[model samples]
Target chain A: MALLHRRLERSYSARSQGPLAAHARTLAVDAAERLGRLQPGNDFSAPLMVAVAVDLAQANAGATARELLERTLRLEPDCEPALLALGFSLERAAEHQQAAATYGRLVELRPDHHEGRLRLALNLIRTGRRPEGEAGLRGLLGAGTPTWVATLAAQELVRLLIAEERLEDAGEAARAALLRTPGDQRQWILLASILHSQGRRPEVLEALRALPAASRGVAPRARYSEWPDLGAAASQSRLGELARGAESRLAAALVEIGR
Target chain B: MTVARCVPLLALALAAAAPAAGADIWVTITAPREGEYAIGEVEIAAEVVARAEVAEVEFALDGRVVGTLVQPPYRLRVDLGGQSIAHRLAVTARDAEGGQATAEVSTLPPPIAADFEVELRQLYVSVSRDGERVLDLNGADFTITDEGVEQPLVTFARGDIPFTAVLLIDASGSMFGDKIRAATAGAATFIAGMKALDQAQVLVFSDQLLVRTPITDAKEILAAGLGGTEARGGTALTDSLFVALQLLEERQGRRVVILLSDGIDTHSVVDMEQASALARTSSALVYWIRFARDADNPFDDGGVTMTSAWRSSQEYGRQIELLTRAVRESGGEIIPIRRADEIAPVFLRILDELRSQYVLGYYPDDRRGDGRWHRVRVKVDAPGAEARAPRGYVDD
Candidate 1:
């Protein structure tokens, strides 16, 4: 019975360690164990236990995932995924600085990993490190990352530019993304937005009018009935005497636009 | 003496007879019509009391001398034509003693007509994003599906397309600390992503909607209001969103909304359902960002209760999910970012999505105003490629 129970427990633990659940559980257990071990001054087993915790956490466990992640750092202090995961977890924990340091370590360990770089940039952005974040995204884009990575990088760059009120630069980035991928609806919208912001009415109109036939059909139509029409005497009549003369004419024009 | 006194008294009594009074002269001049006469010829009529004689009468237009008349209740006609616009006419009548009175009238035309129209073209959009999606769609990977259909492709060209975007920032008190900072940073990033031709309006809301600034450069606007913001009220996401939609409806070109919030609506007058409906009916697209905080904070002194914060955060997440669904239904996308810094990248991704859409145009076969809503559907002729369009257009 004891052996059966032990086997059942092992099986349960193993099942829990499956790819989907392992990371979270591992993190939780690792955190719990590391704290326990650290308090007792058990430094020797800390690294190994923490490493195991990281592995479990990466496999997608629960509280254990975070616990293991912290334990791994307490033990080895430089496991890349542990650091990265810790940083991400820290960010999740709202410990932006700590997360940033973890992300920085991950970047240092694997400079070529675009995901790592991206994560680092994101952390930097959270910490108000605009320049670093911008540079990281730009570098990733220039490095010919995957379409998704590049897209994200480009987006980040463009967003930063826009935040800085560098519309021209933002426009350039948008154009670059468009050039790379012509079917992106968001890019087109952003481009159109930049043009509109600059008071380029004709160009803006042209852009809107030029929406792909597929998307154009979805564009909402003006509700003429709900809108006031000064051009229509009956409709204008509802406005009373105030709808007469120059004031009426102006009101009518407004109605036309509203429509 | 007595006899003299009696005679005097009798004389006085006889002299107690009688007495009387007399009269004066007054004259008045009147014209047949109530208007100003010219300088050449004129007509003057007079009315006299007690047989008084009329000495003279004079007329003028705008204080300029016209003519003089001398007659007693007599008619004299004067004509001076060729006047520009209108003038004020005055007449004076004088008696022998020079006692005179005056009267005047004014002549003018009616008001003129003016012909004028107001042109408002703002932009609005719907947005969505997923953290797990590996395909970083450049401007090319997106297919806009409107109203459960596909549309043709047109205006597929690239560059800085002009538009006006509204940045709706959630300023609820619950989004304190890093959440607020992240939101601010994200807002700044969105602003920085715009082109010079594009304008953005920033609206920050909690229980009430506060328009921080009208459409302007994203960076400057963000910088001005990002600081000194304390997220301490209920979320009025729906109201702010509605305002954005209205603004976009009035603007020309591509319209969009970049909603930066935790997606919790503690104080929204309009619920998510209504907001979704409004989004569907609007031409604008919405990009919702749901910022999630870490759940491991042991110290419970962060103003908001942990359970409430978590609940609110989860609610925000749910709202974001709903918003994402709304964007998808309206041919837009919702982006979720775990970190505050991811805000900028998310915005950029939205932009990329905007550019990559397939624009298709076609003249519909039906042109009748039968007051019916027409459904539009587009499909890719290419193998393995899908297409989408808006649901329908109302013909009234």
Candidate 2:
């Protein structure tokens, strides 16, 4: 029993010591026993049980995981770890609205938590609150925010702008991304495509010329399709067809320029 | 071991104690994740962690024993018909040696699916006299006819009643710059003007449909939703209209769709006919707010002088005729604005009209679900009063 408890405590934050089925069950039973003996109002019991639930849940025992988390929440509704795990579980189960609400609660409980806000924003966008989602993403990119979050925000912002057909803004965003990561073929292709969409043939040629010789051949296909918010009905058939036509358009333009 | 490590190990040994006599079993209710579920048969499954051989598992709801399984795969299904509210679900696992473990989960009722029966068909009727709403009227002062047959009014309510509205805004490329800003402001003004109980959703459509906000009464959230929308991509006017109607169909009370667009249909999977059919069938009223760049009086001849073939063939003529037909049939109106700033005023006027209107609902005497279009007519009894209502509905 002492060895099992020691293993559980040591494996709590270790990536290599992923919870095995037998070990997770043992840990869960041990945690449940400890929770049963602890004073009803003790603060440590809830987190201890939540950790055991997370471990069991990671071991393919989601039902056990959920039950444990729910039990902890019943005692301490503001338990951050339990709420975060439950929200993640609900999200994986495709219960987006419920998951979004859970994450929203997490945001309220821990207003300064970056991951909570990021997850809430994602769930909001997934459930069709585009404005709030976009605003939250932008908020996460503001000054003093984490660099990782800012990088992700920049990608999502550019994707959203391109989706809205704001090519001028998209071009600017793509150029900005290029400045951040110079010689990136992806940004060059995006800049060229945005110029093409705007019917600026000369600028498109200039963008193409700027790309490294090895990177220049086929124009980076503009994927203005795949609107996830629109659900499964948003097919990429039209965009795919347009991309195929673009390949030929680029070929012809290259011949005309004698490149 | 060092003294520090030895002290921690001693504390760990004190914390780990084996239970006396019978082994402790950890019981967990797994299925039916802690959330809401509508009234239906629910299957409850449980997991029992035990060192000893498990004997039986009992499933109960609200303290009543639902079922018990002696073998593995302990699961039970309970009909949750009468349980419309929150209830506690519990599962108890008992070993052969008499040791027992229990787990309980509480659940609330989920949102009812959209297919629920439409009990009352609420209509938002705007009665006007020379471009002004005549708000003072009783239930008996109005008459409703479905397919030319008079419908007995079961219920009647006047304005300030809760209404569910979908603000279908066009963020297409053509509606760039000032147009998008105007539409956003117009939508925000409309949302602000809604009654306390009123709810509105913002749906921005270009080639893609982006739901800015689901049904909500919070002005800040709705404003943020609208403000974040950027105008780009081709217009999918018909597709958006269809989606708006579909969304409003599931809502209760007075249902309305405030469609703000430039009256152009492009890049839509559905056509105007399908969209028109949907609007004709749905009880929700649709108001079209079209933006015109110039003073175009081509359809000023009351649509009588224009031939049917001409109306169908000419692009501008066809769009005008479609809008007129849609508005007239839905018992709504088409408000055309020449300037972006005028949109806020137009929205305010529409909001006023919404507040002054009456809702009338009646069950049809005819119950043949033959799926056919039924033309409707609404008349006002008071002097100098005119009633605007949906032109027809499909019996399905």
Candidate 3:
């Protein structure tokens, strides 16, 4: 359909700033007009409408886009792209629970969808279902998922394990993620922080220095404000407190070393 | 007679045992599946299975009743704070017929504690006096502030640091013939100027993007990628820049995007606002190269005329303005070329400035990583000398 082509072009343009972005915007406006003539339940019209809504969402009209996407899903629940877009929009609006539910349903509908599973796992963690979330991430890695997905899952697993004071497990998970994307500075920091917690100051310094010098200075854009304490989960475990203590000690060390 | 009596007795016993229907009810705890929770509002979801009409569901933590729900999807939110220890989470479902079922789960909740952390912010500073770069400025010669509060410089490194750059060339229909060739040559010149540790990727965009070369320091690879590129299709400069930003997001060291385009946005889904947003937030410096052939002479021959392209519409002017703003916000420079030969020199000049610029790192005086934008101003001790640094950063 003309609407479909225009929508696709508009998607491309929205990501690009070249001449095509303006052209795509104009074409999408025209396509939106023609879209009304098409009947609902035409198999393609629902997606087209969803596409129009996506274009609007890119323009910062997320609420309008969310309504349109919901309407389209009301008619056809199997629209994958629309469902994904809706989940992302919900996330942008800080509706984490709704986004998690949406992604949960998406994973249920398409059991083998990597992106859906990834989003579902992350949202579950966000909603404080750490065990289920960790299981989902582990499952993805064990199922031979894409490298990027596996990398992301491993990274999240490290954070979850660290929050539980499972230092050895966190180190293992961090190492796995690092092997996949050595360029990710956050993973390096996670590893370094873990080492610092075990009284292994030399190992912590080694881990920090192992990272590319340029990336060593960088940190994740977001972090958990609190660190978990040792033996928090198990009564007989030998862990101390969360990684924050180590982070403080390390910060002082860094300042002392003056890199 | 004895056999018939025994069969009747067995049937009566079975009937008595199965006397009631629709009398069972059960509840199950769905969240905190690992029996552990992070320190925060923990959402407890419970599902009820009942053969009879359900009256209500009661939620409890550590044997104390917290709240009751009379809905299909029984749920409750409990603030689990004060200590990092294990507690019992329980739920009970009661049927209208007085039958009840209970489920309990033990979970270790995270302790509420504060993390003393610092984030090191990197700023690439360029100092110029009368259009020439000044590279000898030391850390003492520069003063930096965030939101008007002075920050101490903790890390300072300059020159010989590895750089990562992306050569974004426009191969749109309007840039046919000599323009594409000159752009390719200019790109090759830029790559040749890089140090052994530096890497660059070449991306040519028309309506779609083509990877001329992956990120590499090898000269042969750079040549093979930039060579044999032709102009076709519509321009998608914004898309290419967005892609460039994404590619450089996680890379280490100085990130730069050398964008060579005619300043005309034709066919891109991304508008100026989005581009500007990325530009404002990106750690990468964007150098926009706008090529025009003799704006003063429209009747000249023997070369492609880019002056006509700029003079054709107001849209062109707007596009140029957008690019200029992006450059300024990114603390980068925009060079307008009047001849094809100027392209190579401009590329070299950018490389020179990049190599000679100063790097400053400091932790914000305001250590609260509350995700707020803090404006940064870098000042040089030299009088009449202007310094360019990142305008601001979002603390996280």
Candidate 1, residues A32-83, lDDT tens digits: the string is 3545455654432333344344444444442565675665566556555456
Please write out the lDDT profile of model 2 over residues B1-396, one tens digit for every residue.
012333334434432222234435556666666664423345676766555667888888789876677777776655343224677888888776677877777777644343433233345678988878898899899888877899877556675555678899998777889988989988888988875557898888775565547688887878788877777766657656766676565564467888888775544434466567667777777888877633565235233222110011244455556756877788878887777898899889878887787867665566456777777788999888888877767776
What is candidate 2's lDDT per residue for A5-60, written digit by digit as tens?
53444455464554554565466456544654565655445555665566556565
**Per-residue alpha-carbon lDDT of model 3 for A143-209, expressed as tens digits?**
4686656755776788688778898998888887777678764466567667655657567556644
TM-scores, all models, native as reference: 0.35, 0.42, 0.42
Worst 10 residues of 2 chain B by lDDT: B304-313
lDDT of 2 at B204: 84
Cα deviation of B7 in candidate 2 (Å)? 70
Against the native chain B, each candidate's TM-score is: 0.52, 0.64, 0.64
TM-score of 3: 0.42
Interface RMSD of each: 14.8, 19.4, 18.5
Q: Which candidate tops DockQ?
A: 1
Candidate 1, residue B124: how far the Cα is off, in Å: 11
Better of 1 and 2 by DockQ: 1
Ranking by lDDT: 3, 2, 1
How do the candidates rank by TM-score, highest first?
Answer: 2, 3, 1
Question: What value does the interface RMSD of model 1 take?
Answer: 14.8
